[model samples]
Target: MAGTELFGTIEMVDVFLAMAITIVIASFVSLYRGIEGPGIFNRIIAVNVIGTKTIVLLVLIGFIYERPDFFDIALLYAILNFIMTIAATRY
Candidate 1:
């Protein structure tokens, strides 16, 4: 039973890792959009999307690693991301 439980945990971690990788790839796409966007608003929105995805990725990584501190870091980063977006729009 313990072996089966361990295997299940491993499988879940694998799933989290795959999700993290997908988020990374999507972030890259957002990066490209930010670079080549037609307008300032479009670029700002792209950057915001990347930041949001990064927050999700951080949480996923924290789950996979069983690290509680990562959650705090993710939260702090999320606040920063939000402020940055607002500031970018204002400026």
Candidate 2:
């Protein structure tokens, strides 16, 4: 498949930063939901969503900095998030 469009490195980094900022802003909604949800289940879901976004944000940071090490941090956060969610839901 021949792609008809090409993006410069600077443009690609700009797009990545924009996407990362958008995701962070969007996660603020989930943070608010987690804080003010009417039910515990709703709050749990919101917190989980925030955790998911955090992991994504970590990877995005790695990409923005041109450091692959962030992927490991993201994976660790994913594991912690999963465990915490399971413990929270089970309790």
Candidate 3:
């Protein structure tokens, strides 16, 4: 039973790590799109998506690291990302 529990915990950790890596890769792709996009609107959208993915990745990292403080940062990032997206669209 103990071995099974340990295995489950390890599996969870692995999954979380995988998710983090995926998000990071996605962010990089978004960043590339944002940089190389032909139109301003497309670049803005890509940047917004990158910001959202970054917030999610941050939250996931906090969970993996067992630090709740990082969640606050993630929340701030979410709020800022939303505001920036709105501002970008308006401009």
**Highest-lDDT candidate:** 2
Model 3 misplaced stretches (Cα beyond 4 Å): 1-9
Reference-based lDDT, each prediction: 0.86, 0.86, 0.84
Q: Write the per-residue lDDT of candidate 2 for residues 1-91, one digit (tens) a residue.
A: 1222236434566777899999999999788988988989999899889999999999988888888999999999999999999999899
Worst 10 residues of 1 by lDDT: 1-10
Predicted candidate 1 versus true structure: per-residue lDDT over 1-91, tens digit per residue: 1122336457667777889999999999889989998989998899889989988998998888888899999999999999998898788
Full-model lDDT, candidate 2: 0.86
The alpha-carbon lDDT assigned to residue 23 of candidate 2 equals 97
- Using lDDT, rank the candidates from best to worst: 2, 1, 3
For 1-91, candidate 3 gives per-residue lDDT tens digits of 1122335457565667799999999889789988988999888899888888999898888877778899999999999999998988888
Give the clashing residue pairs of candidate 3, or none: none
Candidate 1 C-alpha error for residue 74, in Å:
0.9
The true-versus-predicted C-alpha distance at residue 76 of model 2, in Å, is 0.4
**What is model 2's C-alpha RMSD?**
4.2
Deviation (Å) of 90 in candidate 3: 1.5
The candidate with the higher TM-score, 1 or 2, is 2
Number of the predicted model whose TM-score against the real structure is largest: 2
